[model samples]
Target chain A: MTGLRLAAVLLAVFAASFALAQGDPRRSGYREMGPALQKMQDDDAANPAMLFVQAGAAAWAEKAAAGKSCADCHGDATASMKGVAARYPAFSAEAGKPIDLEGRINLCRTTHQQAEALAPESDGLLALSAYVALQSRGQPIAPPDDARLSNLRAEGAELYKRRQGQLNLSCANCHDDHAGRKLAGATIPQGHPTGYPIYRLEWQALGSLKRRLRNCVIGMRAEPWSYDAADYLALESFLMQRAKGMAMDAPGVRP
Target chain B: MSRALAALLLLLPGAAVAQQDSMPSLTGKPGDPARGRAIVANRTVGLCLLCHGAPIPEERFQGNLAPSLAGAGSRATPDQLRLRVADAARLNPDTIMPPYYRVDGLTRVARSFQGKTILTAEQIEDVVAYLASLKD
Candidate 1:
């Protein structure tokens, strides 16, 4: 090839490789968080999310309306709950639909413990979710592969790409297209769920993945879904699947 | 068409239809650059600085997701800028930038915000005028 053609070919190859590199699906939100936030996530004692973890452990042991504690049925959390969070938003045969970890917890509560469903984002729910997710910290995210989950997962993928809100923005617009780019002085990370039940410094409290989703919808000037909405569960399934094989970083810290 | 004919055409219902069917043409009293600058920098109003960097120095934490508006006047005409701020999706089907004025085709809008534009026509004009002033 002539010199100009050869240079053009080299540029094309470089551009293709650059695009491929930028499309790394396994990129975690942890790296986008600055050093201070990283330190907060790394140290259990320093992590404010750990406070919720402790609270969750207490809730697990405390007797509820039926005089039955979670420990009574499930025994020690570390043993029984290991890797559970990584597999959630999984298809529930009982519900005959996909259910997230929070939903499953509420299911167990109302059915077996005879307790009322905890309100979404309530301290009790956050604590329990953080505690359970903390147990799966080192486990790889492995959302179930059941056929029942496929429909919801597809719906979720659509939601992730569908533009809503007056902003005419979709989750993919920022989290996918603009990941690693700065937005409002913060880096936009891929919308991964690995670090959910995270303690956000902005929130000054622990929040669930659904809460984060709701905030995004609101930020886009779109109406937000109610807590535990089917759409949220579908999105949760898609996010977890997107972060599959990445280690769980629950009870995580975020800015 | 003549200006009078076009103005008369706009008076008929649905005669204003264009490439972006839902977006209304922005035409009104001239915009004030000073007021425009304030709107763009305001966090709750224009919110331009949140995802766009501008020449404003006092606004800390200006974003870099979108192009800097430092010399936007030299880059594009005021009319072009008006359309972009009004309904950017018409220009690029996939833009993270929010439509500052269009109200239709949105989902899940809060009850109070239903049928509301993020900026008024005058505010959009003001922003466009202010942007037009930012020469390199």
Candidate 2:
């Protein structure tokens, strides 16, 4: 009887130790999932950038400032706006530079939509641009290679290669050189703008290409610039040009 | 230097803790071997052909990115294999694997796949069993 009690106590001690070793008492679940689970959960939504598409779809018809809807001017995106965004980041003669989707949307709103210039990083602007770009999903991106775009691309490429910040590292270090290596918890997707504005679960909202780039810089522990800054826009131009043949998946879902 | 030795010591425990060898073994086959084989070929059940190759006589269209799971039985432990079947990302952490199990806490599943998991728990158990049944 005493030996049986001792065996029972030993088994209990071993079980308790095992339970303690696998911490997070309840394991909180997928709701508060560890990063691995979170990444797994994002696969479908992230790859196709589906949430961005849905959000963009909604933003297309919804009226915004000055009581004007994007639909009020552009009509049905599928019909009227087909192949429109695929031709960006185009050379804008007026701006004398390559203008990406965000700048183009602001230009349209100011000229025809009778709306105010959307403040960079504003939800309204992101939604509007995302809505506009979703129309070009699956279209082969056709970024301009004319003199204007060429100049911007050069500048952007220069910026990407330039060593920046405390780490004195260039974007080339991780994105260009080490495209497929692991970075802590996530696979380093080859930085591409074929999908934006994306709905990222981390942000729990739709965001733009510029937002994604700024986050990358911030992740590198560097000082990031404002949304749609010229430097960032030029960098975007370079990426769109590089990933030209890949099908567009604007307004994508991302982890 | 002591720092290098300390780093090696720290890594030694992680290797021991990984338990790479103690994976669970599949109990008596829980699924029909034929059904599991068909599942591996079917898009709905296996879709394994999308990323892997098989020894089955005929069929093509297998991508070459990932290693062939043809003889996965000898490669990994069953518990670790279960984690991969549940969600490859759960095991690899950086993989692009679809979560075959609803092991990752998901709520309000994505649109196109709103009502279903990539593979049901039963399906995963069966597939693992079938894979375990395979020999080199």
Most DockQ-accurate candidate: 1
- Residue A53 Cα positional deviation in candidate 2, in Å, after optimal superposition: 5.2
Candidate 2, which segments miss by more than 4 Å at Cα? A1-69, A94-96, B1-136
lDDT of 1: 0.87
What are the DockQ scores of the candidates, in order? 0.55, 0.01
Reference-based lDDT, residue A211, model 1? 90
lDDT, residue B121, model 2: 62
Of candidate 2 chain A, the 10-residue stretch with the lowest lDDT total is: A24-33
Pairs of residues clashing in candidate 2:
A30-B105, A46-A253, A49-A252, A49-A253, A52-A251
Docking class of 1: medium
Highest lDDT, which number? 1
Taking the true A–B contacts (Cα pairs closer than 8 Å), what share appears in each candidate? 0.71, 0.00
Candidate 2 lDDT tens digits, B1-136: 9999999999998976575423343343365656667787774457676556666556555544356777777876566666676656445544444566542344323244544566666677777777766667
RMSD of each: 8.1, 24.3
Off by over 4 Å in 1: A1-25, B1-25
